[model samples]
Target: MRVMEAALVMMSGEAVVVEAPSVAAGFEALYEAEYAAMVRLARGLVDTTEQAEEIVQDAYTKVFDRWNSLKEPGGYLRTAVVNGSRSELRKREVRRRIGLDRPLDSGPDERDHMVDALAKLSPNRKTALVLRFYADLPEKEIAELMGVRPGTVKSTISRALAELRKEIDR
Candidate 1:
């Protein structure tokens, strides 16, 4: 475990050194350890690497802002990234409707066949598949993150796997 120097503060005109380890160090370690995986997870939702990295960074910023209050930082960060990606998709949809967005890039070498197929799924199904398979999260956890019941997650995962198999078999 890494420990960073605590800070000193003046309380009632008295100087006191805080004993707690630095949140900045903790967050930095977490960022270093998880950034790549989080980016990949975000990519599963957002498609483009640049968009995925942006989503992850945005999510990390949000998570860092609320770090002290978060009971489960990992879960909180994952939910934030997922929510951020969903928000990005909504914005992209709006841009597409307004004809402000470019056509989605598509080329054999530029895309992962499996990931591309996953991206073609409905949003909820894609989230279910990514959380369950890519993140290795349990069904209950996925349900909570997606705001659905456990049964819904089960069915969603089942259907998503079946769909993926069909795509891969083609």
Candidate 2:
């Protein structure tokens, strides 16, 4: 199969190519497979679609640059995207503080309500919840990506769910 058509092996959380798995080919296949997902995860952090897109693009570029050295491209790429997104948000916050750009607060839409609720969560809870619910990752993989233990993932998810319920009921 062509690199673009390769089936991904993700059960154990690695993106494996069914074919030759050349560096370029494997990276290409994995990029096609996970780019949208990485963007979505980034979207949960950054304000605009453009910012999230740029972050994902940068993350993919870095992953491709280091593809030959990566032991687990899938996990590494995911962690990179999350890290990039957080960094973008921080930089954006600084820009807004110094008046480089206007604040992003418009009236809250329905989605904004969810975003508002998630914003109130500690970064730890928010990351775990987003990965578990939005990305549909297994706990083991989320733990690896978040650099936490499996038990921590479980408790984080549990606490986050409870907190979200409280926010929703408010």
Candidate 3:
């Protein structure tokens, strides 16, 4: 029994040391692998690419800290990136309300005007639009994410597009 206890202690020590070495390396690999995708995802949420990159970096750091708890680290990273981007966007909106008008680069495509118009929508509508159009997610998936029925997603998208069309025509 004494020998078995000593072996367990030795194994635990070795496990800690082994995990220590891999943690940093694992984070670096995850950072490199997901950096661009996260940034792109963020940019679609917020205005500037630089802000998107910063948010993605922040999300990756959070992911690193909770790496072991994540069953799918990639999904966790994506959620973090999305949350960070939304936070930044909300901050920018507050700043705008206070008269801090930063110059925004309107996206190069004409369709972006539609998206920009969509940004004026309520948060739920905007999220539904971005998920449905930008992410190309099906209405069913978006409904699940937004905790609404699929019909709600469809109606929201339809209403959002109608509003966009009015804005564009005017």
The lDDT values for all models are 0.80, 0.78, 0.73
- Model 1, span 1-170: residue lDDT tens: 33233234325566664434657676777788889998998887776889999999998988777777878888888888888887877777678779998747767787777877876676778888988987899999888898899999999899999998888878
Please write out the lDDT profile of model 2 over residues 68-116, one tens digit for every residue: 7899998888889888876765666677669997756645563567777
Which candidate, 1 or 3, has the higher TM-score?
1
Please give the distance, in angstroms, between residue 163's alpha carbon in candidate 3 and its true position after superposition.
1.9
TM-score of each: 0.74, 0.69, 0.70
Error of 3 at 15 (Å): 18
lDDT of 2: 0.78
Runs of candidate 3 with Cα error greater than 4 angstroms are: 1-25, 102-112, 143-152
Best by TM-score: 1
Sequence-dependent TM-score of model 3: 0.70
Off by over 4 Å in 1: 1-21, 94-103, 162-170
- Which residue pairs collide, candidate 1? none
Give the CA lDDT, 0 to 100, for residue 17 in model 3: 32
